[model samples]
Target chain A: MSLCLPYPTLMLVTDRHRSSMSLRDAVRAAVSAGVDLVQLREPDLDDAEIERIARDLIGTIGPRRLVLNGRPGLAARLGLGVHLRDGQRNADVAARGDDRLLGRSIHEAGAVVPDDPPDYVQAGNVFATRTHPDRPGRGLDWLARVVENSPVPVLAIGGIDASNVAGVLRSGCHGIGVIDAILAAADPTVATVTLRQALDRAVRDQQVADTGNHTGILGRGTMI
Target chain B: MTASPWAEDPACLRAALALYLVADPEQSVSGDLVADVAAALAGGVTCVQLRAKRLTDLDAYRLAIELAGLCRQYRVPLLVNDRLDVALAVGADGIHAGVTDLPIEVIQRLGNGRLLIGWSPESDGQISAAAADGAHYLGLGPIFGTATKVDAGEAIGLDGFADRVCHTTLPTVGIGGITSRTAASVVAAGADGVAVVGAILRSSDPRQAAWDLRAVVDAARGVRAG
Candidate 1:
């Protein structure tokens, strides 16, 4: 059997510019309501600005679950996980797997799974998302193939929110990794709970289907 | 494993899953492993998985190299069951990990990103986790129970099998004790296909055995499609 994830992972990618409140408060509230990991991704900010926000989040989100985008040196020294951008460096160097989580982003639709896959692959803007409004989102079918072919768990990102989370979960991904859904929501805590509930409810309903009458796959075989 | 780009395609994965042949060294009546797999491949087995529980690593690697060549000739994905090293060294198209083997998740995490990965999930709870963990397909069963795997637990009957099938959205193959008589029902039980060990390997004409089973499974899925 494959390694069972502790639960459906809910990661919040930090974008202070996108967040409605202070990044620290936003991360803390989301974590309290059920955000499993907080990725501090602010490339525009200088090293000092990024480090300042990361330290504040470390207290609320904890170093173990708080991931810094790039800056592998700081991540290693701070005892936290590291997330590498596309072509940043060899992922294996930063993907030290004991307790540190490693995440890689896939902006393209069908890039082959690299030789050294990360702990989790946060792939896609499955829909034309606000994050990259210009780059057309690589639809659900592409995401399905990635999920099926990937050896590591995939947390689909880009344009993800509660409204369409069930469909994302239906793609058989590990979970949803989001930014604006919680960060920019009117109530980040409530928004986080809503997404978490959608995931739990979808999983529970699927297992329940095992006991119910019909077990046919749904919608263009998306479930498969 | 040599990346079988076709195996990585979702559509191709579903097609390859349709008639999975689990070629166990212990179960093949003929001692020639390659011959048995070749015969099955010729008879329309879309996928071939080598299950060698007793062979030495070098022996397994050498045998896998031959089968990999044979499968390549047929343009079919060859999977080495529970032997990641052999699968990688020989450039087999994929690897299948059972409950006792190294977990697919750990294998994937440790840079096994090039091969198609199939998992044998043991419980209902693991069904979704298998999908989330990125297993290309699931090998679920002991569907009717058999002697090929002494430890393959009780056969989770058609009803029990369908119950588990409902728990996940991944493509799955019902394994164990499957034969021409029961392959259809196993498919009807919600499996994408059925995995057979002795049913084909033990037959004198492995080709015809695979042909007959393939016909049954295809017909069953055809009816579902209709």
Candidate 2:
């Protein structure tokens, strides 16, 4: 089976209003920063608006990977991937005939894997945060369980930062899903580069571990 | 072959489930694997996803064709995962794609209505968006936790699950770590169906396990309806 891994970077699209950073910019930033996938999450946008943004973003992403949150029909219309916050709605949408990449946001171990296994799960609120303050955060321990139990790749979101990105990956997550870290940054590109660097370093470290060399640190050696 | 097992009819989904029987050619999945699926089918599995992960594309294609034939005999639909080429070559009923693979729209365009498409949802927003997008149906879960999906999301509790369901009108099946004991709870939380792998695949008697799980789903749904 093709390996199911998390998007290398996730850019939660929202307007910050300095210069216009539309969905297109979000896509551009993600791509420029080496994001493997980009999801358009304008929950308040109308179908036409979503359609417009999706259309524009698609051109920018150019087959990198674009997910339209909660609008499978539109996603299908645009031939984009669909990410569902709720699995049931996604199932119903699929039943109606939009067969695509259906993903959901899972906050716990038993959140539900759709009958049709999804491409991956975005598990989050890994740390306490300003995003979705109403919900409690799921710590790294809980995140680890999610990583261990899911049938698909789990992308950890909610309060993820460059500092903790390595821990999230080490906890068995396919990758980290960033929100404010990217969207809320002064320079999304810089933030993204830093996070990507950390993630890349983790991968390299993992490789070393896999190669049976665990007695040394990433850059430190015992001098053979 | 036969009509798609995921018929438009909600009753059709509940009447007979599609049972997936996975066997890796490199490693035998155990004869009991078939027995579990058979029992589940007997108990009302209307369809099956024969995912032979270890086989080559050609071999998987042949195996899918064989399994499709068996499903036809049993009047169940068979779906292939991530193998659009094999699915098309085998003429199976549908295809299921993960986020990393082909999008549903591509699947729909390629299938030309002959194949039903299903997606995986990990969050409520994803589910809501997917419902609006017109997916064939969704696989909601890793309900109790499972090792099968190493990167799954946090476990949304039953309350959280119910909350997510409030957003859509689609028929859904719960997946991930589902078992007889937890199946009823998932159904009670408003899942239209329950999909299991190890619960039946790794069982001592897959068939019997399938039946038992089905019974729980049916019973729980009935209670909710009543």
Candidate 3:
């Protein structure tokens, strides 16, 4: 069976370290506000604990909407997508061929091409963030080169927020993967709405620009 | 192999090319290409192409990488001018090739048919060939003539633009000398969009410049639809 990945332009990567609420509540709120994709990235959690959170998130969000970070086997067992770190191997789990959406993280442009390409590439430290203060924001130029060369879609991750989201959209990425922008927000739902709106507006403007007809309601800027 | 997801969606492809912005850091009032581009995107420029002729390959590559991140955030497509390696190295959306650059067909193959190719064609035959060669879009003309690109050739004028647009089904964007004032004419002439350089890059406020141009394009499109 072919793997059909969800085309979510706004993705919320979870960070329990930053969230004011429980991971479940934050995920629930974010999903309610249009955070179509959620990546569970808790490195400290044991396999059992990770599975528990994954199950809970799946209960909150649908099964298809959740991805397990760095846990291909558990993800496959749960029938969810898996986001792999650079060196992690998915050879055993991926061979099962359950048609799961697979993503891999890349830091530089050259990393985009691998022997086993992923369904999508998540790249960054695109901007400076509290999560990884040691790594300077690779900036938009680096991300553009990656997007241009990658055979699959590229998702911008690391240090993304409402302020710089517009710039990221202009860089030609497939979408964004955020951690703090949603999880750390005082109101995760509102933050998710803001990011989703920015993404939707960018896409809507592009569509309006393409048709060269703005006479419709959108042209008036009355309807976002 | 499964067909790429974006390839099946025509609307996505068209949106990829709309409001194509060609940014030159040297020409920008702030002298910061990334900041200028971010501002432009904030004002609704849908696509960006970094055109840095004088910068070294290393310098250009560094800049492209940073801009790629910014463009990715907004979900816009970023193309590079005359630098296939840089585009590849940065994983940009694609490369925008001029007459002197690599042929569209060769670039497409090198990209393994993944990169979105935009070609600048001067005549009807070139336009047709480019479209047939699998160029995702065509950047046609110095519609009103300007000094932005030293070798932009002659102005195509509104009639010429209309003639060219009628000759090809590929999405076409009029480039060279277009500004908020004259952007409507290109849309009226049937071009899908407009590609600009100096008008926004050189303006005091790149953001406002982009916004004004977007407004003009939308208004013109509205008029055309009416």
Candidate 4:
């Protein structure tokens, strides 16, 4: 399947409880530092609070790049994307048509991106993320394997930060999604900028290795 | 309201933009902004802007809910002024941002085109720039001097207001001090409608005031069309 979004991208998986700053500030700062996508994952708050946070976030970064976690109906209503929890095949949300993106979380090695409705899958505990501390990192090798056979681009998550993000990007995953890298940092802008630079560097280096030209890597450059 | 058969008509924008209300809680005669807005709606306000500076966030959200509900029943659109959070939370139709509010270009990029965004630009440059800035409508004015909003810019008057209106094709609404007396002149100045505050709320009879203002604006639109 074709990747519809920008690759070698950075996504912020926002956790309000873990953020050192307000989630809104963190998301805004991260977007300013080139975080291409935001996944609003705060499930504890009520729907009203979630929607307020979503709008505030949208005002900063806009709605096209934001995805609501496990809130398909709300996401659909806002004309934004939705991220499904593990093993949810909610056809109703997926079939709502072409204007929105549908994302999924997967843990198994045998899993495949569903083709009926094009989707990108976020796979991890790639490196022992704080959000899921108990699960050991599945490692970059597993990530490479996932990218190797996966039908759609994969966003690696879990404990992956600027320090370890390059290795994750080298695994051929489309991008990385992190929580503490931006949210819990002393300054989210710096944190996001660091991660963004590292991710861009890694992708640049890989392009050099691939064919000595950035344009040589097929499907790696297109946004749509 | 409905985007159906009228969506094909160019006047659809004018119809929605005409007879607009800039509903402010601080200026409400009865201290009940929701009821004030409902009265204006009954008097044929085509659109409403919930502009609150003194109320708590919850109060504003509650009022937005009531006003949005009223606008829904009346088949007019309700927009929240400068409070994107309140607007989004209450599921209002749009946001009316000022020159200093959240940048409209960012809203256009990230908003996924969900809310009907309205912006006020006081000059020719801003009005021209607004064409590319994802503004669905332009709140252009101080068409006549207004005391309700003390900080409003100097009155653009009829001639200056008309000169700026020609710069953009977006549905235009003249704001800042429009009243039954001056509302028709705003429409005659090329604005699709008129936006007012004290004209509706501070009046002895807000519904009647709105009815008079709506009629005046409609007649001017007819004149301009003819």
Candidate 5:
């Protein structure tokens, strides 16, 4: 019930990069494709416009997550959650009183862990990402350390995609936060579907390794 | 793979900030408002409190049920402000009480630990008392003066927050006229979390405003020693 899974690899596919589809349309498309979560990061729009789009997307999202990047008020009004961007600062903590999922970015493994932590810590750019250039990639080892030591659930961020999601999971990350993988794609739905499948498989594999459930898979079902 | 939810989850409540969804039955809360909640949920908000000061209990109860459904879908907890019957009727996460409202022990007994009982503490003495009474969390505030609460107390700057929080064992959140601009200082003052009203609900982009505040808290938490 708690999305705070031990090995959750989230794909932080933002609505910023897609030019053809609006955020609402893109969110719908992403939901159809089964992205584990979607964060709305478009800051140019006004609140009313954002609210209109948020309402549109929330209708389709159901139980799936929709994170508002950098807008706690809108989130608060709607009673949704938010994701704090890296290196941003504010004094508003009232928004944290909500029982919605709360998360933030970490430039490094150290930045990811807080003495008073959030729901999850996002450590990023395991690979090169187009969204951010100021940050150098932290690579897989840093991610592993984050996964191992994080006080909260740790998610690998920056430069993550379907092709490398499996590897990142294998490296001990619980989740993946993506950008170009879904946003830049011609078909975000397909990309999301594939990414989710890959992460699921990796989690299953990790679970199998931990529990040795190979026999159960072999006994009850064909090797998927 | 089967890690305990609490174990892997952050030690502090994920959404320590209180997200107030002001309700109105005379004029229905917009779909955009509901979706905003969903979007906020997506953004990782941890709690929602329906402040239906205008609606009748029955109407509020119905709305609470509907909102609770939305919160449930997102796995976020929903609370009702000073409406125990409505909360119980709709099975909300809990109730947030003001000083004049029900006493802490009554709420605790009523909640039976299933609900999180938050008490509004105006001073360090109140915070200490709330802690002693096993209040789930303290809403310490009027961190700044605002129009939100009429006759709101004097603004307790970050320094004052630190002074008050230093005395309480329970998780404390700085509230009252809180905005993204002041979030970092509150967190830096040793508050466990922050709460707001207009910063998001009144913003042009509530999501972004929420994110801005969240970013501040994240930064504030960074100041602590390892």
Candidate 6:
């Protein structure tokens, strides 16, 4: 399937409980400040509730930017896309033949199969997040291995914030999927701008690093 | 707000590709390759590449590990020349391949487009093919001819280099015989930057040499901007 996945260098996954504002408002604000993709991840909501939220986000996010977590039919109905958990059924969804973006979440390396590949894979928790405190963060090495083995681009999710984003870029993931870094911030819009700026700087830094540019010494005056 | 330029996106394959330092152990004054690299970085060499033509596989692997550490400490990318295995072993940022090395397509597939691939293309046809093959950047020339790489093909000359640079959107670094005196002209001829081996390595103070070359490159880019 030739799916044109959204350019998700920085994605915001919604958790209304973690925010002071409504999901729609937070998403709208974040989108304005450079959050390129948003995944509606309210697992407690029913199909009707999801559809309602999806429609609202569709208005705000437009085409290909909103991904409905675990509800392919709802996504297809709204002309939106679906993000599947590993072991989730997609063949039935695939047969529906509505051209929408498809993504999957995988935690381990070599989990992506060539025969049934999603357009992009969301892999993480790259670092330990408060939401999943019991689960240890899979360090950058694991992330890099997963990126190398996967056929599709991988977006790192979980525990990624401004401080650690550069290391994540160096790990070779296509981009990052964030949670508290935006939702938990004092000002979600400002937080998103900060994260986006960090992401942009990290990207430029990675590019500079990849080009063999000296990294540790350039702007910090630590040369020598 | 207007849409962001494709070039501004970090995930896009564009690199600064400026002030490339082709690290040669034999040419280092201190007889210490890593030390020389540190000195060069201090002087503003933007990139560091380890080109160990005479080291054994184990030795190269050992040295790459050390050099990669130093590069990581400085946040510079460590690229291993012509040794994909060493690059993979050290977890280097990329590899610089000569024509005789593995093809760019093979490297891309093996690297899964994760590792940046730099190719040295001699002709316009080769440069075009390299870009189409998705090479991250092209290292073009023997721009003025030099003794660094005995087999560095014929010098492309300034005018010829300019003609070649116009052929591709991929960033190009003019290599071979680039010195502070000639570095400006190379940048003027439309190179994203100049890659030097002897100019920095053979200098009494590699840092000073790199600083001088960087001044020339920055000035040339300023001229291009104006």
Give the DockQ (C-alpha) for candidate 1.
0.01
TM-score of each: 0.49, 0.45, 0.54, 0.48, 0.49, 0.50
**Tens digits of per-residue lDDT for model 1, A99-203:** 666777865434536676677777876643456532333444456767887787888887677766766676788887899889889999999999888876665
TM-score of chain A of each: 0.86, 0.82, 0.89, 0.91, 0.83, 0.90
lDDT of each: 0.75, 0.63, 0.76, 0.75, 0.63, 0.75
Error of 5 at B187 (Å): 0.6
Please compute the TM-score of chain B alone for each predicted structure, in the order given.
0.93, 0.83, 0.93, 0.91, 0.82, 0.90
Question: Tens digit of lDDT per residue, candidate 2, span B148-218?
Answer: 65566776667766777776676666777777888888878877767667776676665566557654664
- Candidates 3 and 5 compared by lDDT, better number: 3
Order of quality (TM-score): 3, 6, 1, 5, 4, 2
Task: Please state the error at residue B179 of candidate 3 in Å.
Answer: 1.1
Candidate 1 Cα misplacement greater than 4 A, ranges: A1-224, B1-3, B223-226
On lDDT, the candidate that comes out on top is 3
How many Å off is the CA of B34 in candidate 2? 4.7
Residue A120 local lDDT, model 3: 81
Segments of candidate 4 deviating more than 4 angstroms = A1-224, B1-10, B223-226
Error of 6 at A58 (Å): 34
Give stretches of model 5 more than 4 Å off.
A1-224, B1-10, B14-32, B223-226
Cα lDDT tens digits, model 4, B189-208, are 88888888999999988877
Q: Which residue pairs show collisions in model 6? A: A212-B47, A213-B46, A215-B75, A215-B76, A216-B74, A216-B75
Report the lDDT tens digits of candidate 5 across residue range B1-226: 1221211223424333423333322223233456555444433344667777767878777778877886654334577888888987887777788888888788767766466677787666787788677567777777788766665678876777778888887766787777777777777776766776666666666556655665566566652111
lDDT of 1 by residue, B1-226 (tens): 3455534566557656777888888888997778988778656576789888899998888888888876664446789898888987887877898777887777676535777889988878888798778688899888887989898899889998999989988888999899999999998889877888898999999888877886688678762110
DockQ of each candidate relative to the true complex: 0.01, 0.01, 0.03, 0.01, 0.03, 0.02
Cand 6, B chain, TM: 0.90
Better model by TM-score: candidate 2 vs candidate 5 = 5
